[model samples]
Target: MATSMRATINIARGMDGAIAEILLGAVKGQNLAAERLLALSAAEAPLDSNSGGTLIASGTVVPAAAVGDDSLVTYDTPYAARWHEDQELVDNLGRHYMGDSNFQNGRKSHYLVDPARENKAELIAIVAAGVKRG
Candidate 1:
């Protein structure tokens, strides 16, 4: 039997979804804008007390292969990609929208939802939803 596991990553406007998928290993890295990975934003699906989601912000993503335990890696990009807390950038961007008063008031906006193979699969689905602000 064939089974599938999914890993998701969200992308916001102005964020390169293709490049993001590549960095996450959801897609391959070929002819990408920069040799270095750029940051992206994650967001929640709906704005409600019970609704939950996340957004990814633009930042540097080192290839998993380049990481060696606690060893350091080098990145070269136009925008300096600083070291960020693990998955913290995603959480932070989500908070930026969810925590805003105007967003909570039902204003409409958009968020990107990306789906891919859970463990390691190429080809991803990037869907953008028109959401009410918040």
Candidate 2:
């Protein structure tokens, strides 16, 4: 004769649900932070020519609030990329490229970075507030 035994296990009820809610709250907080950064960066961006106001208009923020979601802020116009990279560009007259000569220097537009640095404290506060709300 032979005998067999079976075992069963059960997790605490609502544990997974509680954990999921906590995670979702954190994600929402992060998204709010990203949005704040994007707005600050755009506001601080330099505007001289304002030809099409494309540089300022191109500012955007992508919120990450789910698994595999990556947050990002971007100045998405074609020239915006070059400007952000500190690359030289031809003048409106197409005579010469800016930043090649000393008069027109190719300098990194710290539009996003500068604001982030200047408002580090404020941003931290914002994040803290978000956490508290969450």
Candidate 3:
């Protein structure tokens, strides 16, 4: 004995057009997310106790163009990596170093990471605002 079954999906508007609309919305959401991320990262970014420039000035965003795409925030300064990664203020020699003074305005390391983590809900909301659902 054997059993057979058949089913069909009747999409009134067709799947390709629907998928395209969703993808377009997702791109818009990603763009909004990138912009918000830049702002959040800037505020949480550790400012130099002295000049308080350069690194912050190099912040930028690359918005996504489709679903599953990446939205990136980048820093072009030479010391951007050092500043963003050195949470403990320790040098390669295993010595604690904070230059002349500590970061100003209560700012610390992981400037970009911390902000994204702390304000995750807000970031999601920003992106979700651009997406639409039935």
Candidate 4:
């Protein structure tokens, strides 16, 4: 048997702990506070965290959440004031999340949208894997 889980990984060269918390919380059906999502950067400029950032999550389980049978979890690169300006950053985030050891085992993954057909060049979710909390 398999259970659906919804997740979004935000990678921008920093911890993004608060943002992770928001995503985690959202999965658990919690309403996140405004401060939790405070933008660290505008469109032209990006920000890095002062502390080393590791992936953080909110909700029922730390890294995994129970999703509805048909829920779709989408991962769109962070939208900035100017979309095209951060192409490299977005690309790197997608590659790292897909290739990173943190997510390698257990779950199956796929690109939500093909970058080849889309100028957005960000990852969109086509499918996700069923995973157990470690």
Predicted model with the maximum lDDT:
3
How much does candidate 3 score in TM-score? 0.74
Instruction: Identify the leading candidate in terms of TM-score.
Output: 3
Where model 2 places Cα greater than 4 Å from the true spot, the runs are 1-12, 48-52, 87-108
lDDT of 3 at 57: 77
Model 1: per-residue Cα lDDT over 47-115, one tens digit each: 334322221223224433321221122233222132111122335445532222334443222322121
Worst 10 residues of 1 by lDDT: 125-134
Candidate 1 lDDT (Cα, 0 to 1): 0.27
Task: Provide backbone clash counts, one per model.
Answer: 14, 0, 0, 6
For residue 88, give model 2's deviation from the true position in Å. 6.5
lDDT of 3 by residue, 5-112 (tens): 999879975988887876787678878887888888888677654678667778999877667889999888777787777745776789986543356786766888
Which regions in candidate 1 have their CA more than 4 angstroms from the true location?
1-58, 66-98, 101-134
TM-score for candidate 4, residues paired by index: 0.15
Give lDDT tens digits, candidate 2, residues 25-129.
666766776788888876655453646356778787787858457668788777665555454766688875554222122323666777778888876776566
lDDT of each: 0.27, 0.66, 0.77, 0.26
On the 0 to 100 scale, the lDDT of residue 124 in model 2 is 70
Clashes of 4: 6
Error of 2 at 32 (Å): 1.2
What order do candidates take by lDDT, descending?
Answer: 3, 2, 1, 4
- Superposed Cα deviation of residue 16, candidate 2 (Å): 2.4
